[model samples]
Target: MTAPRATKTRTPKIRENLPAPQTAEGLFFHYTPEEAAQWTPFSARTLRDRIAAREIEYVFNGRDNYLTGAQILSLNERYTVKPFSKTHTRVAA
Candidate 1:
């Protein structure tokens, strides 16, 4: 008799229901790399570099690259480091 294989399941990291950016003018569906960079702590060049590294998600509309608010948020979350308490002990691998 053969044993059944085990499968692993993972939940998605990013929330799909996240809304796009809402501006004073109106809700912008997407933001250009330059605009997206302004929203985050990084620069436009950094965003481009990240795109090249496939670290962040973006859209290419033929002429330029654009990013949705959710994607930018995901990028930020991916790099966000959680701080450990001073009393917390490190686990050795």
Candidate 2:
């Protein structure tokens, strides 16, 4: 009897919307879910969940939702932990 061949499973490619080149200085661009995922460790679905739960702020440009770089940075900052300082000594009661 012939051995059955194993089929290869492929992951679907995520389509991302690239931001346009800045026409003026100091102007920022918005990112799609896929693009935002590239900047953060969370997946696109997580981002969407965050948006739905109002955990993160987002902008709706008439038809589509977008996130700004500042917003992503703010989200990251919210989860960042500050290191504990070990300079002070405990006082005896």
Candidate 3:
């Protein structure tokens, strides 16, 4: 007798639009790359690239990846550069 082969299967999910989860600050939800592109200057492709590169934190919900608002804000802060003061000048020895 031959052994049975294993296979993978996918199930469909159906649900109505729901609001984001509530927190001490306010409502918060994980955004897909497509949605994240709307609030960010980067495109969905760029965000996905970042996700693949592990440049930013993300949640892998079984099938898809998601980013929280906090993660986006953290990424912004991480890459932000401080401007040099005009009063500062280089001294020549």
For all candidates in order, the CA lDDT equals 0.68, 0.70, 0.69
Q: Please tell me which model should have the higher lDDT, number 1 or number 2.
A: 2
**By TM-score, how accurate is candidate 2?**
0.62
Better of 1 and 3 by lDDT: 3
Q: Sorted on TM-score, highest at the top, how do the candidates line up?
A: 2, 3, 1
Per-residue lDDT tens digits for candidate 2, residues 13-67, read 5554554323232025677766777767688889988887888888888987778
Per-residue lDDT of 76 in model 1:
72
Instruction: Answer with 2 or 3, whichever has the higher lDDT.
Output: 2
Best by TM-score: 2
Model 3 regions more than 4 Å off: 1-27, 86-93
Clashing pairs in 3: none
Candidate numbers, best lDDT first, in rank order:
2, 3, 1
Residues 1-93 of candidate 3 have per-residue lDDT tens digits of 998876866433323353333342313577777766655667888998989999878889999988776676666677678798789788999
- What is the TM-score of candidate 3? 0.59
